[model samples]
Structure formats: structure tokens, C-alpha cells
Target chain A: MDATPVPETTATPDTECHTTHGYISDKARYLARLKRIEGQARGIHRMVDEEQYCIDILTQISALTSALRNVGLGLLDDHLKHCVVDAAQLGGEDAEAKIKEASDAIARLVRS
Target chain B: MDATPVPETTATPDTECHTTHGYISDKARYLARLKRIEGQARGIHRMVDEEQYCIDILTQISALTSALRNVGLGLLDDHLKHCVVDAAQLGGEDAEAKIKEASDAIARLVRS
Candidate 1:
């Protein structure tokens, strides 16, 4: 009797899950981080409204920026490792496009 | 000499150089930081090209995010302190616009 399990297909699907293929596990973590960041942003708004000291407000804003950027980096990493790598392994037009897309994304981030 | 050097006019101008009034001192720091962040971003690109381990790439990206965000926060803080506060003190449509602009910026960051 045949006992070997069938290998999952590596064919890259053109679907919505492309960038999120391997990031599902980290979804909760990402969401939680975003919520905290949102709260931090609101805190900054309050500081501004209250006319708090400039230095104090700046400090909080700095922290909020750190939090948001961290999340972005996390997502970018996930997309690269799972989606881009997977597509590359398939080795075709899709691979080329994926790599180029990632490069462009990086360029945009660097510019910002 | 007058006991107090003539107080620079708080009158917000309709001309350029509004947001940068208080941030000039930090210009060098910001430039250095942006250069480092740019290098880090390029490094990520190299890692992907080399097909490095996913975890390693993620770690580096995470660090880069922190660095970039810190810079952004610094700039935002400066803008709020120098530009927004000054405008608010003057109290007019300009102040309202500045505050609204900052709020919109916060919202964008949170969404990101």
C-alpha cells in the first residue's frame, strides 16, 4: 500500500493571501501592537489639546513612531520570508515581479 | 543694549520656513539618523538577494523599523513644538490648520 503523503503544491496563487501566507501566525501579535500604537497616538493628541510642554509631547510622539515602524518592519519581514521567497523558488515571471515589488517597497520606506 | 534683545516677532508668516524654526538645531542628528536608516534598509535588500534565513531577515527588519520610527517621532515632535505651538499661540486659522494637520498625521501613522 502507498504510504507517502502528497507534497503541497508550490504553485503561487494570484489571490489576496499572497502577502499573508506565512504571517497568519503573527496576526494576533500585529493586531495587539497596532492597538497599543493607536492608544499612544491618542495620548499624543491629548497632550497637544492640553497644551502640554513641547518636550513631553515630543517624547511621546517619538515612542509612538517607534511602535508603528516596528509593526511595519514585522510585516515586511513576514512578506519577504514567506511570500517573496516562496514565489522566487517557483522561479518565473512571478518571482521576478515579487522581488521587484519588494525592492520598490524598500525604496519607498527609505525615502520616507 | 536693551535689557532684553528685541523679542523675535511671534507673528506667524505666510511665507516659507515655518515648520523648521525650532528644528534647525537637530538637523545634524536627523541627517545622521536618516543615513543609518538608509543603510539598514539597503542591508535588508541584500539579505533577501542572498536568500538569508527568514528569521534573521525579520530581526534586522525589526531593528530598522525602530530606527526609522525614532527619527519620524523626532521630526513630528519638533514640528508640534515649534510650528504647531507657535501657531496656536498666535490663534487664528493658521493655528487651526496646523493642529488639524498634526492630527491627520497622527491618524496616518496609526493606520500605518
Candidate 2:
């Protein structure tokens, strides 16, 4: 028993696996979204370098902003669906903490 | 080797453990940050309930926004330090993906 590394007793095994899945998927999606955003950012940089119209540059920036917001929302959704839900299921301080965290994230996202 | 579970053939084992550590720490910090944000949010709710001035509510809301941004920055820092760094060390699609993802997150956070 001493030889076996006891996994940290943070959350249940099931919850950990579920949460891990959500995180893994989120990471994958985030990477894909980022690659597209990179192209967009580079395009914006090129536009500025080429002395493109101010409105055009602004428009590209706005699009980039929206794209980024989408990624954030995606991450937020995963966090809620997996992490917060698991924490809530566990109940007590963990749940309360997750709820508050989600609230803060939502507040920030909406405010932007 | 067959029974050992190839660990999904993702990032290296050392990288995985390091990234996991960073993620775990971030989760703890995020939960703490959220708890504070929650109190602020509840205070805002009470202010609204009491028919407090709009500017006051807005100011509280602004504070909340800053708090959320700080949390986001914290997550971003961890992601860059762990995920992005690990991925980059591997040198390939994975690294590129992490870089792009980090860029998107940074862009969104700054835009907000």
C-alpha cells in the first residue's frame, strides 16, 4: 500500500476523470480556436503595416475580439459543465466556491 | 507495454505532471478568487435591492470586472507557463496549438 502513489484526495475518482475529460476537450478546442485567431491577429498586424484604412483595422480587431470572446465562453461552459458541476455535487465549501467562481467569470464576460 | 496504458500519447510524462500541477494550483487560486468575487457580487445584489445609486452599482460592477480580469490573467499565466511551455518544448503541432490558444486568451483578456 505504501508503494502505491495515492492520488490526491481532492475530488472523487469519477469526478476527476469526468473533469479531466472536459478539460482535455476544452484544451483541444482552445488550441484550434487559437490557431484561427493567430491568423486573424497576423492579418491585423499586416493590415497595420500596410497602412490599411483605420476602419478596416478596427473591424478586424473587433472580429478578433469576438473570436476571443467565443473561446472564453467555450472554456467557461466546460468549466461550468464539468468542474463546477462536480464541485457542486460534492457540496459544502467546494460547491460554494465553484458557484462564486462561475458567477465572477460570467460577470466579467458579460461586462465586456 | 501493452497493458501499461500508453497515457494517450499526448505530451511527455514529465510535461503532463508539470501541467497538471500548474492546473491544480490554478484551480485552487481561482476558487479563492471567486469566493472574494462572490462577496462583491452579493454586495452588489444587495445594493440593487436597496435601490442604491446606479453609479455605485456600476462602480461595484467595475470592481468585479477587474477582479475577474485578474483571475483570467492568473489562468493565462499558468497556461503559458505550463501548457504552452511544455508544448513548445515538444516542438510540433502541439506547441503551435498551445501558442495560438494562449494568444487568443490574452487577446480576449486585454480586450476586456
Best by DockQ: 1
- The global Cα lDDT (0 to 1) of model 2 is 0.66
Q: Who wins the TM-score comparison? A: 1
lDDT of 2 by residue, B1-112 (tens): 4554555553344434334744566587679889999899999999999999999999999899889877776665455445654555555555445544545455456566
lDDT of 1 by residue, A1-112 (tens): 3221222222234522344355556666654554454355445444444444433444454555555466556767787888788888887887886676667556545543
User: Model 1, which residues run further than 4 Å from truth?
Assistant: A1-112, B1-19
Ten contiguous residues minimizing lDDT sum, candidate 2 chain B: B10-19
Interface RMSD of each: 17.9, 12.6
Model 1 C-alpha lDDT per residue in residues B54-100, reported as the tens digit of each score: 33444554555566456556767787778788888878887786676
Candidate 1 iRMSD in angstroms: 17.9
For model 2, residues A6-91, the per-residue Cα lDDT tens digits are: 67654344434335644576577689889999899999999999999999999999999899887777676566445654564466
